[model samples]
Target: MPLTADLTSADLNEIRQSALGAADPLGVAADLAHSAEAGRLADPQDAGLALSLAAEIAESRSKFDAAQRYADAAVTAYGDRDDSPAAAARALRARILYRSGRADEANALVEPLRPLLTRYPDAAAYVTAALAVGGRARDAERWLTEAVQAVVAERGVTEPADADDAGVLFFLLQQRHRLRHALGLQHDTHDNLAERLETRLANANSGAAAAPATDLVFWPRAEFDRLAERTDAYGATWDEHRASLEQELVRQTAAGRTGLALLPGSVDALTAQAGIGGDPVSPENRAGYARALATGTARIAWPPERNGACWCGSGLKYKKCCLPRSRG
Candidate 1:
């Protein structure tokens, strides 16, 4: 009858990871439902974990209807007793509403939680969820930025020199990038931000830090090449350009360079110069020329003059990993 005996340590750990991975409520709900039905719900913590995961998974999967049920279950299992957990459940519900295009409803749901932000400033999940649904991009960006700063301060670390924490930092950096892009700020404005991240990576490498290979997730390199080709296609739409830039941003952020600047030009200009539509790469077309210049600029300006070394200790330029795949 001992709970510890009934569940292996590995099983517990796996469940814990799954719980943390729950970015959707429905996923968390389904997991907990299965566990409860199987008569395997052991501890409150485990149950809470199941709820969180289910909710997150459901949200990400765009199953808002299912997510609400799981969020409620999680709140109930957590006894709806603790303010933190309750707030989290509420946030999950809000996320579902937001994803379902009921933004107004979602905003109203989390409006009451505004006061909590000042108290639990470091609660990135709560803050992000609240801002996202609240229809306040500027506010959300500020909160997210502050939260990241507070985390860095609490750790007494100026830089995330550790590779194991790269994933988390990468997400933060991506958020920063998105915020800047959404604001329509000039690309040069992020130059300093890019430098700081590059320096952090270099510092980690200098310390001979070794990130667990197991923790690293490698995307297929071919995907990047394919994206490059697509972006190069003649008559590419704005959406296509945006998608390509977004993918490039994700890749670069993972590698520790957060700066992604889009050139100030119209999509038509880009397509015309690239000779994209069966048009040969020519001086008049200039598409190839522009692409080459952009790629070259990124590489040369990378490592931000502030970052002196590579985080992998390879003594290579940060752009080798952090820059977009070069066409030139």
Candidate 2:
């Protein structure tokens, strides 16, 4: 069967989670890998991710040959990228090789990845995990410490920008703590912080933490510009509608509902998409559409890269636009 072009990151995550819970997880992962290899996925990098995940699943099941093949393909799919994801795939490849008793090859494959340790916390974490997988417990501990120090020097672990950043820090700290405990080492300040972070994250996940102060909505440039240029027949301004959307987001968050991303539409777009007559766009029409879209399985995480375009349809960098507004 062909993979859907409209698959979002959320959909891929859901698929992976489902596979993990299935009776034959390796089968589900292998099937996804096959579909991804068919080149039907809209994002080419997703194919690499699918293969990498399948490789991990196979390795866990002790299907080393299949795992190695999937890992090799994942490396090829990434193809010389210097990003963390590529590094992760390479690290997984090495781990697979090590687990298959190709220790020399595994060491060689991972040796060059040491430089990545200073550059990317995420990549370094993966490399350390690979070392642990190869039973290099001492080496893994030292390298993990290096990774933690590098990240603290660059971007302190205490202040994370979003849940994803928090998750990375959480993993780094959790793994280090686990390693220390296993090696009969005493707990340190870092270990204490890790315990606190774990508690905080658990609370947040359980809906006991406070809601986010603000969230962003995506805006296609053309539509945003068109809406900005005029008011609707119902006497509501574009700015008002935008503010309404923000308020609605706040309301949804306060109600303990997550994943409330909004991709608002102009009346014309809405009417066309909904197959309705060209009735002038009303505030009620816009609100109803937004509420309906909020319940979707797909989500768009807020706070785009600081240097990237603002999610508010503004033509400025996010740091200069909505990000400051959200903070202050």
| Residue 116, model 1: Cα distance from true site in angstroms | 5.7
Model 1, clash count? Answer: 20
Q: Write the per-residue lDDT of candidate 2 for residues 68-152, one digit (tens) a residue.
A: 9999999999998878889989999999988888989999988888767666667776787788889887887787677666666
What is the TM-score of candidate 1? 0.44
Q: lDDT of all predictions, in order shown? A: 0.49, 0.65
Candidate that would win on TM-score: 2
lDDT of 1 by residue, 1-328 (tens): 1233334335545655665454643444565556743557555355654665666666667666777777667666767554665666666667676767777877876766554543443344555755665566677766556545554555563334333554444445545555655665422212223333544566566863332211121112333233345333311433333333334344455755544443333334435555546433232233344444354432322233324543223355545533332221
Query: Model 2 clash pairs?
Result: none
Worst 10 residues of 2 by lDDT: 210-219
